[model samples]
Target: MTDPCGECGARACEELFHGLLALDHSRAEPWGPLHGVSVSCFLLQHAGRLPADGGAAARGLLQAYLDGGLPAVQRLIGRARAANSHRVKAGAAPGGAARGTAVPVGREAPRGGFTVTIEQVAQGGTFPAAGFPERVRAWAAATLEVSGPHSA
Candidate 1:
């Protein structure tokens, strides 16, 4: 596996992927904060996986969570079944059309990078059972600060 991804310079992405996948996503007693919070932040930080509009898509989604928490994210993503049905009918695939393609309409993407990469997240996110949620939040917040409107 990539120690630090060549494209995004983040070392923790693969590790974070595992940690996120381990979380309980079941409708019953889910790890609520994590389910809504982690992915967008990861995408924002990773940068390379982002749509052609750049990590703007991810940053905007992260801002949604920052602005209104889980409910806001849920409102943005809405019911999964309904979203999937709509996606199928519209012939739209998940992750949008493809790489280098236009992202769905939204504000222009952030400065297109991260000040704190996933290496820090992985270093800090070890021992997932120990304060993982807070660590993720802090990492994401740091990333957002640099990716925000005044990044220079």
Candidate 2:
């Protein structure tokens, strides 16, 4: 089988999941990169567990990763795009087209569900931008692709 979405080794998933669960439970702000929320939720929904505290202490480092880690992000995006392309070529579904690749109108995709949040934190605070959630989400997905074993 293909790599399990939740098993990707990027620790960002752990952090994002905790932060998002905190947000869902109204404990913490729904703040981080969008990728973080997406991957975090993906892990939670698909894996049935998240790290304790969701790795909050590592959030700043994850955010910095989004802000400056271009190479890692690009590699992840490449893998994701290639994987999606393969799915499309294999006639999996219509909506699985890779990012930055044009998809035909009215194409249906498989039920791959994900969500994200948005927030703004003051400078020197926890989250640095309103779009932090999106960035986090991207990094989380990227890390999953490049970091650890593709399976739990």
Candidate 3:
């Protein structure tokens, strides 16, 4: 869990690393235009691993993507970066603004039509491209659907 991007809650930091790394197994960039959605969905679902601004930016981008399309998504990504909104850091600690328990996500992860960790997504597998791009869009859509209404 010491890895800043290990919020996926793998049994071990190595597991988490393998899971996230597996996304690139096909050596193709599937996120493409939906990069914001892919990232935002991942960030928002792991509420326990996100900073306040990160969550807001994620939710906002999803809303923007729905209301204003790619342009809006790009704009929010820029602003989020400026705000230092990003995957939770190791020393960020688990308290206050962070929702959900800071503990590592496990099999007990809630199924909200969205994955709680990169490992889960990887488990779906992506071979010969494995429809990674489509998976990202679908995952983003589901994340938005279960995320409830967005404000601002």
In TM-score terms, which candidate is top? 1
Tens digits of per-residue lDDT for model 1, 2-21:
56665446665677566655
lDDT of each: 0.56, 0.38, 0.52
lDDT digits (tens) for residues 21-112 of candidate 3 = 55545344653455557556666555554554445556777777767777887786676455554465644533334444343333232233
Winning candidate number (lDDT): 1
Question: Which segments of model 3 are wrong by more than 4 Å?
Answer: 1-28, 32-34, 79-123, 127-130
Off by over 4 Å in 1: 1-12, 24-33, 79-130, 149-152
Write model 2 residue lDDT over 1-152, tens digit each, in one string.
22324443333444545555454454344442234334433433332333332322123334434555634544555565676674466655332312222222343211223332211111222344466545555545443333222222
Model 3 C-alpha lDDT versus the unseen true structure = 0.52
Candidate 3 structure, TM-score to reference: 0.50
For candidate 1, which ten residues in a row score worst on lDDT? Answer: 24-33
**Candidate 2 overall Cα lDDT vs. reference?**
0.38
Residue 20, model 1: lDDT of 56
